[model samples]
Target: MSKLFLLVFIALSQRVQSFGIGSTLYCYQCVSTQPGCSPFNWFWHWSQACPEDGDTCVKVIERKGASEVVTRDCLSALKGVRTDIPADHYEGCKPAAVDVKLGNYVFSSIKELDVKKDYYDETTFCFCSFDNRCNGSSSLKVNKSVMFSLTALFMVIHFLILR
Candidate 1:
């Protein structure tokens, strides 16, 4: 009987080990109209662990005029959303139109551009990363060479003007 119990215990332990711990992702919880937390404001106190079914961290942004409404949450792999179509339909991404006007000189527009286009639906920004605490902050990529050249050009112009 003791040997049988030991075998059963070992089997259960192995099953638990396979599942493992730290399977949850971290997300932020805040609102755009909540007093001190306004317009993409986030606090450490609002961070939370994702649900058992969630495997990725997500940040959703919707732009309204000059302010943006942001929501950080956890996401599952198979989730879908509807946009510019009927219900029960899912398009991973959609094309959008953008208009730009610079003073009275240039007025230009772009039509049908492929944006992030994910299951998050029609949003200004929808980002997803597969890791714990990945959604804690906004991610940006900058080219070091471009930045360095711009800086050097500005310094050269400044020196010429001062001389």
Candidate 2:
């Protein structure tokens, strides 16, 4: 449908603009407690540049009682908390057992963080590197090559449908 195409187009366009030439990488900084943070809508509005020291973007989601809390920001923003990661990491969210509630935040970009020890029902963290606004909705982040391939495939499908 045209709707799907439009969505894809918009996403790709935003990605290109965000990750384009820039000194600091951009990320979607928000808290689920606030509007547009929950059910995270990854759009230009949420994109924010990370600090110069910020090398990664993070997203953490915590499920408490009847609601979920989400947090998204630069890895460096974790002031007092420490996030550990293996030398080898990739872009994507890996679910870890929750020791406590994490507000939707980033990782593999990290291995662990003792940010808070208050046990929660569930929590998930996602981390990504180098890309602007890389920490957005959909824990499964897409790479440039894949996005291009998808765009090409969709264009073909659209042309075929036109005929």
Candidate 3:
């Protein structure tokens, strides 16, 4: 039958070119400065004094200057706090702080420190595009419906191998 319709049209065009090769999007960042305060300040009373199982400080006093004193936590203020993967997949603005790793969509940040006048709280990890952390979008719509049902089963085996 024409070699089984050229081996099912070359195996459905190599499975639709391997589903258009893997897609990706991950991010991370954090800034905290305080040298006379006002480095994009917005602590809002230390994020309402964080507590719900999230808050492990060593030095917390984001502002109390007379000579100098503006500490923070999460290990020495900030400086590239690990985990990063950002080539600009999404983020229009509002990335002053982010940390949404829910279900492994990944996103982390921390860097930009120097407190003394009191101004430390600038976490980051932003990525948006329907903000699901950029998962495979339903596995690319189920691999485009299995590459259009394998291109209609290779056009019905090329019309029964050219009849």
How would you encode candidate 1's per-residue C-alpha lDDT over 5-115 as one tens digit per residue?
546755654443332335655556555455433334344336566665645555546554566655555554224531322222121222222223312353334323323
Clashes of 2: 19
Ranking by lDDT: 2, 1, 3
TM-score per candidate, in order?
0.38, 0.54, 0.25
* Candidate No. with top lDDT: 2
lDDT (Cα atoms) of all candidates against the true structure: 0.45, 0.65, 0.34
The residue-by-residue lDDT of candidate 2 on 136-163, one tens digit each, is 7656365668667777887787778754
Estimate the TM-score for candidate 3: 0.25
Candidate 1 TM-score to native: 0.38
Per the 3 Å backbone cut-off, how many clashing residue pairs does candidate 1 have? 0
Considering summed lDDT, which 10 consecutive residues are worst modelled in model 3? 131-140
Q: After superposition on all CA atoms, what RMSD does each candidate show versus the true structure?
A: 20.6, 10.6, 17.1
Name the lDDT of candidate 2: 0.65
Q: What's the residue-level lDDT of 79 in candidate 3?
A: 29
Tens-digit per-residue lDDT, 1-163, candidate 3? 6777678777767755543223321211122354322232333222212221321222222222333233332321232443222333243322232235422432333323321211434323323333111221223224556767877886786777576
- Which has the greatest TM-score? 2
